[model samples]
Target: MKLVSLITAFSLISGLVEAGNERKFTTIQPDLTEIRKAQATAQPYEFKEEYVPGKVFDRFYNIWLENTDYDKAAGEPHMKDLRKKGITLTNYWAVTHPSQPNYLASVAGDYFGLDHDEFVRMPANVTTLANLLDAKGISWGEYQEHSPYPGFQGFNFSNQETYANDYVRKHNPLVLMDVITSDETQLSKIKNFTDFEHDLEAKKLPQWSFITPNMTNDGHDSTIKVAGTWSKNFLEPLLKNDYFTEKTLVVLTFDENETYEEPNRVLAILLGDIPEDLKGTEDDTFYDHYSLISTVQENWDLPKLGRNDCGANVFKIIADKTGYENIKVDMDGVYNNKSVEGWFSDKHIPLPPPHCCE
Candidate 1:
């Protein structure tokens, strides 16, 4: 009897070892120390050719050269590490310049086409992609991290309005909006990132969810290492989370590429619930903020609303046939033609508006 028990124990131990070996971990981590060190070495400011102006195609081609270099020399290894751990996106695009506009564009499908931070409520005439989702009876929520102060809690709330609303209202205006407006209780559904634990524990997940991590960690002005680390720490686990992996899609992208001229490249990462043809692939498709709006419209079958809509192309990052079965075309072949030297043409020109408030 003792010999038989010993044999069973040995078999269990061997199985554990094999299972451990089969699991792969991501290579990237939010390394604040490394990020700070790298930033220390960066020169105060320097120009690069990628910022120069030309045709859209030529401009992107030139920018790609340096971006390829920057990624290869700095962030490439981390990207590979992410891929090994199942975090990847074949084609992604930065939604806009500055930050807030991109965020608005993602949900609204029009940059609201605003030029300033004026907090006017989105016009009733403008149809938002979020509204479209609401109509379809698909559930959705915005998972804001460290909010409760910025008035992001509910839909239709803005950062500027948090003052009168107090902590919860200030932080999550979106929730408040739905509370007052949406009859389906969609506002109740919007939650803080921490709330993810409860949903996971209860085994409840909506068809669509939008998550936004806080300022410090999201790679806005922070060092790439810090951003990458935050991404790894939060995302690595979520990728493995059973609920997220099966039908969910995770999009990681910058609001804007910022002022960097060299590399002139920002990131767009998509993962989860992708079709076989679209999975584990990388696309050099030329795209911008409007592309995201276009994608959301296409996914929900919503109508396009602005000037960009007429010509905008949505690059399908996840082509899950079983779920989002929209046929995709090659976005690269679409006309990249521009009347002027592309948007970057103004890089060297004198600014119509000064750095200070005009």
Candidate 2:
């Protein structure tokens, strides 16, 4: 009965995801302006905990953008300018196609074979990077550009006037995992950009943060140029912000590549309190979505997820700072263009149990 019920739930979730493609968001106003006005009334929860220092950096911030091939993104005027301010990850690859899976993999160390941008949720038993950080009393949060409110579980909110995909659930990694979504306290930490502003001003930002801009700003609905411009404008001022950058590691990266036929390489820029000699440099070491998890774990000595993160390379800079050697991957034919079968996939192959201590 337990096994059957679990399978039934997975099938139902898959059905809802397929049906959600055309469904208008009912919880929030369909009009983007009205939605923003309404969301203003939602109290943004302020959470601040002890700053657990990591080996290489005190705080880590990752800003995620949308689809753009490595060269296309790297060649953008604003991106090029940003590259000169920090280390450019020349060989960093995304884990898979579409977008959401890469975000999921970044925190969970695996995407469980999800293939598309769908309204799916993981079971409560599944844990993520948050748990690892929580275990060590480290603080973390996610700031999504246009999320209606903290702890929102809607499929996709759009502009009723333009019918554009605005704040999407798929782009927000923590929302997909039930481990975070099920807990009200954890959900409060998954806030919008407005909350980010409040936190930033109060100097109450978490030790680790995952930031995702709106669909348009992130280039999902626009071009790489727009995303690059938005990224530079948003991150440039923080370079001198004392509260934000003392021994901090800021990463600018994409969820996945725009081209499905090519390898899933994306342009990533490393900045914020980096060693001066490493700035304006290019690191060609092979990396993927799992590298995000590995890098965080390496810095904080967090427990292994016992999945892909176990084998993923830590950020070379973090490795060098912490005296940990990063592994070099031989990328001959590791093209993660399509996802395989799992609980969320159309095939609905049951997901394996989470290996907490593998």
Model 2: CA > 4 A from native: 1-41, 160-163, 346-348, 354-358
Give candidate 1 regions above 4 Å deviation.
1-77, 85-91, 117-120, 149-186, 260-265, 275-279, 300-311, 317-358
Please estimate how well model 2 matches the true structure, expressed as its whole-model Cα lDDT. Answer: 0.82
For candidate 2, the clash count comes to 0
Estimate, for each residue in 51-138, the C-alpha lDDT of model 2 and write its tens digit: 8888989898999998899999999999999888899999998978788788888888778767777677777888898899999999
Give the clashing residue pairs of candidate 2, or none: none
lDDT tens per residue, model 1, 1-358: 3423543464354333322122121222224454345434432111111211111100000001011212432354555555544334334444334344445555554442232322323333445545655565545555565443212322222234443221122222233222223433444455555565655565555545556555445543345566667767776777677655665555555554444343234566555554566555665555555565555555555555543443445454432321433334454323211111111122232212211211
Q: Cα deviation in Å at residue 46, candidate 1?
A: 50
Q: What is the C-alpha RMSD of each candidate to the true structure, in Å?
A: 23.1, 6.2
